[model samples]
Target: MIVVTTPTGDIGHQLVEKLLESGASVRVIVRDPSRLSDSIRNRVEIVSGSHADANVVNQAFEGADAVFWLVPADSKADSVTAAYVDFSKPAAQALKACGVKRVVSVSALGRTTPLANQAGYVTASLAMDDLIAATGVNFRALTMPSFMDNTLMQAAVIKAQGTFFSPIDGDLKLPSCATRDIAAVATRLLLDESWTGQEEVAVLGPENISFNDMADIMSDVLGRPIRFQQIPLDAYKARFLQFGYSEAMAHGMTDMADAKNRGLDLGVERSADNTTPTSFRQWCETTLRPAILD
Candidate 1:
């Protein structure tokens, strides 16, 4: 059985569907089973609880061949370490106790750069990968840059004002991926059992494109003039704080954006093996257009 955590999330839900399509026996650890469609709940064994719970994961991991692990973002956590590393501690222990063979996890890019240690959430995620790797299970950390679909969060604003914002420079070209591609890659890795040992799989999207380029694509696809706005890092953190995120978590996000701006993600060179197929234009056409227009 292949166990998946956060099965209701954007990437996890897609991964579950792909796994089912591939005829893999699937089990999912979810907080609420009602969030799953009736069709999905019928098809997979459901372990209704947080994967961060020791008993829940231990039960779910029993007799499982591989696992798909993702730590849900906790904006209210006291610190980045608490959000990623500490939350994952229970599952790391469960993996060893249950003897799971393989794990495919969602992580961020920037492990090799000197800025990694100061990259906040990315730093904690890398530490989480290390904690899991120490357990000796065959592990693949799918490291990625920002997701193009994240733009969907500003769909309403874009439709109303024809503008989007971020702390990253509008002209600083950087790789951004689509979550569907990430799910597709995770599905492929979970289905195949031959690969062993721990490694980071960099899922860089087809090419590096800046926010200005993305705005152009959005404008063309959505039939409106959309623009990119670079907000101050303090303003970005303030937005998070306004949403009730703790101070530490807010700083973590600000640090991550700052590190990205400083070339933290540039540590890895793009290659055919690591690059994924989705481009910003294609994503804007298929994903962003609908979110803004419909």
Candidate 2:
């Protein structure tokens, strides 16, 4: 059995669907079983609690051959590091105690970049990877740049105002993968047990596309004049604070965006092996468009 965390999240949900289709025995640790569809609930063993809870992971990991790990975002956390690394400490320990041999985790790109230490949430994610590696479980950190699915977050703005906002420069092209592509890669890794040792699986998308390009794509896809607005770093942090993030947590979000605008996310070059199949436009059509319409 493979233990999956965050199984109801965007990518996790897709990964669970793929694993189910593959006829694999799957188990999930979830905070709310009700969030799971009736079909999913009937198919998999469910541990009903946050995976950050040691008890939940310990119970879920028992007899599991591999695990899909993801630290769900906690917007109200006091610090980004606490949200990522500290929150994952229990689950990492449980992986070893439960004798799980393999783990595939969702992580970030920019390991070799100078900003790794200062990239806020990205820095915390990388640190979480190191902690997981310390457990000696065969680990694959499926690293990715900005997610195209993030567009869904601003869907209401796009629909109402015909625009979206970001701290990153609109003209600066950077790799961004769709969450579905990331899930596809994760599903492939979790199903295959032949791979061992700790490594980063870079799931960059098909190409590097800029926010300006995204606007153009959105305009075409939605048949409306959508625009990309670059908000100031201070404004970005303020926005997070408005969302109830603590001061430190708000700074972390802005710092991560600043690092990305400076090209830290592009530290890892895209290639045939690392790049996944989804493009920004394809994501716009499949994911973003439906959300805006809704």
Candidate 3:
């Protein structure tokens, strides 16, 4: 049996679907089963509660052959480090106690880069990989750069005003990934237990794409003149804060944006195995276009 955390999240939901199709006996730890579709609920064993809860992880990991772990961001968190590293402590302990053989987790790139220690959110996430690895479980950290799917958050602006915004410079090229691509690699790792020890699998998308390039692709795919706007870091933090993010988290986000703008996410090189199949234009056509249309 494989235990999956955040089964209803963008990546987790897709992972669950693929695992079920492979006829794996899947189990999920979810805060609310009601959010899951009837088909998923009926198919996987449901352990109802947050994975951060020790009791929940202890119960969910029992007899599990492999597990998928992800520390979903909590905007209301008191501190940035607590959100990733602290949230994963229970599951780390459970993995040791349960004797699970493999763990595939969603993580970011820049493991040994200088920014890994300074960038608040990335620092915490890299620390999370360390905590999990200390348990001696065979781990594969699906490290990725900025997600192409993040543009969906600005879909409304794209549809209404033909513009999207970010703190990164519009001309600076950076690596990107689709959640679908990440899920594809993750599901494959979870199913095949042959690989051992800990490793970071870079899941960079097909190419490096700038926000300006993305706007051009969106314009072509959506048949409209879409543009990229570079908002100030303070403005970006204010927007997230307006949505109820804590002061610490909002600042952390701004720090991460600054680091990315400075080429922090470009530390990883795009290669055959690491570069996933989805191209920016392909994702814009399939995912971005539909979100804007809807």
Candidate 4:
């Protein structure tokens, strides 16, 4: 049996679908099973509970051979990180206690930088990577680049202002990719059982494009002119604050945007396996458009 956590999330939803296609006996952890689509709900063994609870983790892993883990955001944690290391430590111990070894995880690029702060999810994510490694499981941490889907948060702003705005400068070519691509790689690794110990794979898109190029692509795809607006950091903070982000999260996002401008979050330019990912233009044309239409 294979276990997956955060099965409703962007990567996890796709991962679950892929696992089902492979004819695997998959178990999924979901807080609210009723919210799941009929298709997914009918397929996987549903284990209801929070990822942070040990009993939930134990039940999720009971007889599983491999597990895909994710420490996703929660309603109460001021940090988007779910005390990531603490939450994951128990899961790792339980995975070991269950005598299951093969594991794959979703992590971020630049897990090393001290500047990434607590909400600096990259840092906390890396710590979790190390923690998993120390547990002696055959593990792979998918160090994914900035997700192209995340840019949709700007769609409302883009529609309203005819511009995409961020604290990330329009000219900086930070690496990025579709979450689908990251999910593909993670699912593949989970199924391939040949690799061992601990490994890190960076999900670099086929190319790095700037917000200026992104604007041009959006315009071409949407059939309207659009431009990039570099919002002041304070204004960006204010915007997130209005959404009720804790002050810490607001600053983390703002600082991350500023760091993106300075190339702090740039992913590796090359992949070890030589997998070329979808370009932003193609991702927009093929994947994002239909979602926007729906």
**Per-model TM-score versus the true fold:** 0.99, 0.98, 0.98, 0.92
Candidate 1 structure quality by residue, lDDT tens digits, 1-294? 999999999999999999999999999999999999987999999998988899999999999999999999898999999999999999999999999999999999999999999998999999999999999999999999999888888888898999999999999999999999999999999999999999999999999889999999888888879999999999999998998999999999999999999998888999999899988888888888877777
Model 3 lDDT per residue over 78-178, tens place: 98889998999999999999999999999888875788777778778889999999999999998889898888888888898999999999999889999
Once fitted onto the true fold, the runs of candidate 1 whose alpha carbons sit more than 4 angstroms away are none
Tens digit per residue, CA lDDT, model 4, 100-183: 768899887765544445335566677788888888988888887678988787767777677777877788887787888877
Clashing pairs in 2: none
* lDDT against the true structure, each candidate: 0.94, 0.91, 0.91, 0.78
User: Which run of 10 residues does model 1 get worst, by summed lDDT?
Assistant: 285-294
* Model with the higher TM-score, candidate 1 or 3: 1
Q: Positional deviation of 54 in candidate 1, in angstroms?
A: 0.4
lDDT of 3 at 9: 92
Residue 99, candidate 2: alpha-carbon lDDT:
96
Candidate order by TM-score, highest to lowest?
1, 2, 3, 4
Name the best candidate (by lDDT).
Answer: 1
Model 4 residue 260 CA deviation in Å: 2.6
lDDT of 2 at 80: 89
RMSD of each: 0.7, 0.8, 0.9, 2.2
* Model 4 stretches astray by more than 4 angstroms: 80-83, 112-119, 267-269, 272-275
